[model samples]
Target: MSISIIRLGIDFGLVVLIWMIQLIVYPSFLHYTTTNLAGWHRKYTPLIGYIVGPLMLGQLGIAIYQVSTDFTFYHSLSILIIAAIWIITFLQFVPIHNNISKGRVSESMLMSLVRKNWSRTILWTLIFLSSAVQFF
Candidate 1:
């Protein structure tokens, strides 16, 4: 199969995943009590990581390969956006998830999670759209 097709599939998976996270998963945290949320978060993070980790790695690996092989505008932009998403995930979301798992969650924090996640949602959507345009 073509690399562009593979890249589009990965990007599509991520865009769907991010929308689910943004619209459904994160917001649902607000409904739980602090203790329940913490307990659930502990389990949820690892479970979700299983799905997220491979997709992210595939996306990143494909992005790197595309850029290194072709060095086109689309590949370069895709890699830069992927890099930003990685930075945001580690630098911003990881600490928040850690705190939540440790029972340090507050309403504000939950709200912040939903709020901050918009950036990722938009970025992933853009990646998918760009991939689609390139593929089609």
Candidate 2:
């Protein structure tokens, strides 16, 4: 398959994944007691990373390739947005996840995860839709 197709798939996958995490998984963190929360989060983090890490890396690689080659508006924007997502993931979300995994599962923190995640969720959705426009 073509690189563009692969990138679209990555974007689409992330859109779905982030939505689920934002709406379902993060909220569900609240259900776990504080004692169990850390262990559950620690386990969930690595497993989710196994899924999310590759897709995220793939998307970044694809975006970078696209930009380096033709450097079109969409390609450049896609890379910039992907960079933003990565920045948010590492700078913002990762810290929160680290905290959660340390058994610091507060309602406010959970809410923050949900709230901050909207930036990523919306960005990924836009990228997916933009890629779809390119596809069609």
Task: Give the root-mean-square deviation of each candidate in angstroms.
Answer: 0.5, 0.8
lDDT of 2 by residue, 1-136 (tens): 9998898888889999989988899888878898898988888999999999999999998899999998899998998999898888899998898888888778998888888888988999999999999977
**Each candidate structure's count of clashing pairs:** 0, 0
Q: State every prediction's TM-score relative to the real structure.
A: 0.99, 0.97
Q: Compute the lDDT of residue 86 as modeled in candidate 1.
A: 100
> Which tens-of-lDDT digit does each residue in 35-58 have in candidate 1?
999999999999999999999999
Per-model lDDT: 0.95, 0.89
In model 2, which residue pairs have backbone atoms overlapping below 3 Å?
none
Q: What value of lDDT does candidate 1 attain over all alpha carbons?
A: 0.95
Best-fitting candidate, measured by TM-score?
A: 1
